[model samples]
Target: MNFKELGISEDIIQVLKNTGITKPTVIQQESIRFIKEGRDVIAEAQTGTGKTLAFLLPIFENISPNINTVQVLIVSPTRELAIQLTEVAMKLKEAKDINILAAYGGKDIGSQLKKLKGNIHLIIATPGRLLDHLRRKTIDLSKLKTLVLDEADQMLFMGFKNEVEAIIKETNKKRQTLCFSATMDSQVKKLAYRYMNDPLMVTVKKEEVTLNNIKQHVVETTDRRKQDALCKVLDEDNPFMAIIFCRTKRRADNLEVALHQRGYNCEKLHGDLIQAKRERIMKAFRNADIQYLIATDVAARGLDVSGVGHIYNYDIPENVETYIHRIGRTGRAGETGYTCLFIDPKDQRTLEEIEKTIKFKIPRRELNI
Candidate 1:
């Protein structure tokens, strides 16, 4: 269906078309009408499925520019996601002059306070900082018409369930609520039951967690020689743009340094980096100035880069869900992609668990080099 049929404005549709998003995604098609109808919705969709636009489009339709006093509140788990949401909102609302603010920690609270005092139409915030604002009573949610919990599973995983509940209590009970997640775990369901009023559940399912267009392979190597194994794989793939997932920030930092020393165009992303630097790195990577991005799971939560041709698991994630999320970075937007995972002996059990979760064994390759 077209964006106009989904009740998106002609101006916003033009903006989307200019951005090359003419057709609605699966998540967008399912969730937009429900959201526009003012129904509570629990939408479960995979990463890179255009979930952001699903909720945002409905919000843009509902918000009124004349009576703006924070009509919509979007709570996200990570600052990166919050920032990305704010960017999308700004683009859609630019012609309409709707004010948008992204509130998150690791930034100046005084400045956020100043923005909060203005006639803001929408706010995209992390739970911690939004709670801070709630505590200070600097922002009022009395006029809120909608509340969005983006990445609900991730918020619960980060131990923000209580915070999220508290934030919801501050909003009007009759207000529209929407929860979006990659998985509809029990916690997400409970939150929906307790808060949402007869919510519509929408899920985009896959027979397996792995993507069909993505070629997956595993390289067996010793822990001591895993670095060499990764180098060998990079030499072979020569990907146009790649992301390497590490288990920790220290590992990401070390890999960034090592890869640069080896003369690869690479960058590192983790929690330790300041917000400005993180944005700069993301910008560079999107522009293809940085060919490889080494990141931790938390740091890569809201990454929506296109043309990510390869994903390298420098260290296998502890769980199958994380592995799916990490590899979901590639094989997006109908593009074929590749994934190479380096596994050590100690990771055999985890590999088995991953295989069990995804319901297929990844083809194994010996590190012949």
Candidate 2:
């Protein structure tokens, strides 16, 4: 359904129209009404399903323009996700004078402290960094009206449960709580029960891994030969932008170096890189200066890069859900894309799980030497 049918504000509708987001996704259509009504919500939607906008829009509408003492608090698992959410919030360009800031670790605390002094309506932060600010008494969440745990499962996975609990206890007890995750585990459910009031639960069905607009294929090769095979694919396809997923930081770094040595414009992103370097590499990739981005799953998570024409799985993901998140980097916003997975014989079990979860067999493509 169109956003207008949801009774959104005219200003929001105009902003959405300018971005060509005339219609709401299934999750948005269902959750927007409840969120607008200021209800606690538990939404389960896959990545690349426009879930970010689903919660942000309602928060924007409900915010009071004059009183801006951090009305909305969005906690993300990674620094990259926090930054991405802030960017999305900025795009709203609400009629009210609202300031949205993102705070994360590994950056100069001085800059973040300076931004905190301003009138902030919304603060998107990572758990560790947010707690650091809380310890310094720099952030005042006394006026917090809504608290969102975006990618709740990932936060738990990252071992931020204690920090998250601490942060929640600091907020107003009567505040509204919202949680969104691609997959929910027992711990995640327990966290919700402990923190959230009687909340409405919404689960958006997981679609098949292979989008109709994307062509998914696998190339079987040994670990030693995977780079050569990837090079061959790049030579043949020459995609405008491609994201190569490695299993670990070392793998990503090695792949990046190999690609560079071969005279390809490539960058590496992993947890090892400093925040500034990661940001610079991401900027280059976004600006189309770097055609290839080799990253580990953690580093790539929560990145909202656009125009990625191809996704290469240099190492098969350990879990089926990760596979879904990996391939999702491409074929976004109704754009046609390509996904290729380098599968070794040892990864058969993981491949089977992925196929079962997605309910489709990935087509196998033989490498042409």
Candidate 3:
């Protein structure tokens, strides 16, 4: 359904239309009403499902441009996600007077302090940086009307539970809370139960997860030969664009070097890189200047990139859910996508777990190249 029917403002609607987003995704459709009504909500949906807009629209709808003292606070797990959210918020607020700020570590805190000195209606931040500001009393949440925990599960995974809780305690208790997570695990539930006030839980179950548009395949090979296998698969598949998932930062680094030496247009993303380099890499990847992006799990989460033609698991993920998250990067927006999984004999058990989790066995293919 159109966002206008879901109570989005005409100005925002026009902005979204300009950006070619006329229709609201399922998560946005189901969660907007509750948020507009100022109720605590726990929204569970997969990545690329418009969860960012779901929480963001209602915040803008309820925001007061005149009284700017950080009316809305959005906490994310990573700097990239926080920056991405701010970009989307700025787009939605085209020509509007709302002041948006993104606060995260690995940047200049002094510059952020300068921004905070001015009027800010919305602050999108990572938990650690937000906590740092809160401790120093530099940014006030006393005027906050809404608090959003974006990618709640990831934040908890990154050991931000205490920091998040501290941030919540600093805010007004009467404020509206929205927790968006990919999975409603026990940690997510515990956080909700402790802090949220009779929250409404909206979940999309695993059975309803759709990957029909994606063509999935497996290539059996050893760790030492997996890089060669990846090269063979890319040659055969000839993807428009691809992301290669590695298990560690070292793997991503080595793979990136190997691919570059082979004269492939490639880049690597992991935690070790500085923020400036990371942004440069992301920009190049988005512009299709880089055909292959090798990344670790933490570096790739919550990235907003469309038209990814292939997802390669150069190293099998540790868990079934991770496998799902990795492949979910492709096959977006009804586009046909491909996934090539490289696995060794020891990974057979992990492969079975993934099959059991997704409720189907991925077709096996031998790479004769």
Candidate 4:
């Protein structure tokens, strides 16, 4: 359906149309109406389903520009996701003089404290960093009208449950709450039951896992030969942008070095890098200055990068869920993409598990070294 029919403001509708977003996705059409009506919502949608704008549009519409205190608080699982949410918030620049800030760990808290000073309308933050601000009294959530837990299941997996609980306790209990996740584990369900009112539940059915639009293959090689194989694949495919997921931070760093040594523009992202450095690398990658990104699962989850033509699993993730998240980087928005997995004999069991989860056998391709 058209966004105008969904009761969006004329100015916001103009902005959306300018971005070529005339029609709402299923999640947006279902959730935005209730959100505009000021009801708590729990949404289950996979990545790349246009969930970001679904919540952001309604929140921006309901925001009272007059009130200076933090009216909307969004808690994300990672610094990358927090930055992405802030970017979406900034896109709604039609809001008059609204100040938005993102707070996360591994960055200068002093600078974030300075930004929190006056007339801040929206705050997007990682759980630990938000708790730090709450403890320092640098920000107050007493005026909070809306609370959103974006990627709630991931936050729980990352062991931020206590911090999230503490932050919620500091906010006004009467505030409207919204929770969104790809998979709702029991922990996420319990949090919703405890914090949310009779929430409207909306779920998008999981799409069939298919490689029709995305060409999938495997590179069978030893650990030492995998780097060279990756370079060869890139040389052949010539992707405009790509993300290579490794299983560990050290491996991601080493892969970045190897790719750079071979004269490929690349960057590394992991939990070890400082938040500022991570931001810089992501910015470079997004701008196409860095064509290849080597990342670990923790650093890559919840990132919203479009036009990624290639996704290479430098190492098969231990769990099938992570495998799903990794390959999800490509084949987005009906675009043709490609994914290659570097698998050794030892990883056969993991591959089996992934196959079981997807309920389809991934086609195998033998690579000539």
Q: Estimated TM-score per prediction?
A: 0.93, 0.91, 0.93, 0.92
After superposition, the stretches of candidate 2 with alpha carbons farther than 4 Å from their true spots are: 94-96, 115-118, 208-213, 356-359
Model 1: per-residue lDDT, tens digit, 280-339?
Answer: 898899879999999999899879887899999999998987888888888876678899
Q: What is residue 96's positional error in candidate 2, in angstroms? A: 4.3
Judged by whole-model lDDT over C-alpha atoms, candidate 2 comes out at 0.86
RMSD of 4: 2.2
Q: lDDT per model, in order?
A: 0.87, 0.86, 0.86, 0.84
Q: Candidate 3 at residue 143, lDDT?
A: 74
Could you tell me the lDDT of residue 134 within candidate 1?
87
Q: Give per-residue CA lDDT, model 2, range 215-258, as digits (tens).
A: 89989898878889999988988999999999989888888888
Model 2 residue 50 CA deviation (Å) reads 1.0
Ranking according to TM-score, highest score first:
3, 1, 4, 2
Top-scoring candidate (TM-score): 3
Residue range 144-231, candidate 3, lDDT tens digits: 8999999999999989999999999999888888999988899999998888899988876543344667789999998888888888
Ranking by lDDT: 1, 3, 2, 4
Q: Mind giving the per-residue lDDT tens digits that candidate 4 earns over 178-287?
A: 99998887999999889999999999765622354777787777787888888788888888999999999989878888888889888999988877888898888877
What lDDT score is found at residue 39 in candidate 3? 91
